[model samples]
Target: MRTGILSEVEDMIVDEVPIALVYNGISHAVMMATPADLEEFALGFSLSEGIIAHAGECYGIEVENGPGGVSVELEIASAAFMALKERRRSLAGRTGCGLCGVDSLDQVCRPLPALAPARGFHAAGVRQALGAIGARQELTRLTGAAHAAAWCGMDGVLRIVREDVGRHNALDKVIGAMARGKADPHDGFLLITSRVSFEMAQKASLAGVSALVGMSAPTLAAVELAERAGMTLLAFARGDNFVCYAHPQHLAVDT
Candidate 1:
């Protein structure tokens, strides 16, 4: 179940495995991750990064465990394949980390496609969603070393949640799950247990999520990105109080 084990003591070190994402027969990135739910990992990584428009665009996903590590073979739409080919070619996936392989400004500040206007949402719904997300993190309860990304509808019911040691990976897993389930992104808001950064904002926008709620503070760049993407950004989501960064109109809070 783990890699390194203590002989005298009885503690297990969590296993880390290298998982590669291959898009249309061409390898794109190799990342060190917990070797579980990898099929979901591959889908989440692709959907959150804008490699495919939706799960329908993803033809198939295959998982192969080998001596080197795990390889996820993803068959995507022709247009996505071409776009990936034109973009960056190689990536080294670090452990549960974000923006590890990005070495250029172009990649960091890529323009996002316009998003739909945000619909009004009840404040209580957002609060209930956050509570539900906290309750749904089974792995986090076990390991206490993972982050969770979740989806909640306007009614405040959390429908989906994914956990990973890395913040980005968690979000990616959620995105992939949504794609595989063929869920509509416009139907809900995304809640995360990590800080809001530029890449996080990028992924949220790519998923067409109307609003992003984070338990931690957001970077200036993240706020700017969310504004451009027409998504609302909320930070410091503790209890019933939060700081709204963009699109405050969507928040139906009592004066």
Candidate 2:
């Protein structure tokens, strides 16, 4: 028996597929993600995961669809490939799980470089980006289940936006797109529609992004990481209100 209030209706849902990041014929990790902007995801994951030091070290990337799922094969410089092998561990990724399949605790936190101080950032710019980003999120508008990551100029212009079933994947996609486009990381801020976590902060710092803004609160670990990295971290950002978690000095208050 069907309830009167419940009726069958067709609905659109976000797609989450298994994405394998294969390096030098070695399967390194697998993640659940939306099958869009995958090339950027691959590049971003590589850089953030420290698989390669720079984009130039990545010689090529190939995406293959198979019965299991999509596999992103990356060809990188021998040096980088060697480093990857040394730290090689299979990651059994789940949606939004940043740390999975790590064999030991030692690998949990990798050392990161201190970020250069961000400049020209204002609270008003954060508000402006927050207001404009919703309109640019096509996937979220369609599926309502996708998370978004956007690259925004200090002036509050949304330059690039990427969406995925997993927040981390979305961040990786936008970071990859930014690198592929040769955008200077220091010149802009990263806005994500997810809580700021340690891995999220780590990835942004690795990309040399000086500022990271989020639509939700940040974890304590994330706050500490951002503080040490000298990154300006903000969360719980809505129209005109936001909480600064780290390096508030970098963000100028708009009068």
Model 2 stretches astray by more than 4 angstroms: 1-4, 89-103
Steric collisions counted per model = 3, 0
Among these predictions, the greatest lDDT belongs to 2
Overall lDDT per candidate, in order of appearance: 0.82, 0.90
Residue-level lDDT of model 1, residues 48-152, one tens digit each, is 776777788888999999999999999999998987876654443334434644645577776676877666666887788876776798777776787888878
TM-score of each: 0.85, 0.92
Q: How many backbone clashes does candidate 1 have?
A: 3
- How far is 225's C-alpha from truth in model 1 (Å)? 1.0
The local lDDT score (0 to 100) that residue 41 gets in candidate 1 is 87
Clashing pairs in 1: 30-93, 31-93, 44-176
Error of 2 at 50 (Å): 0.4
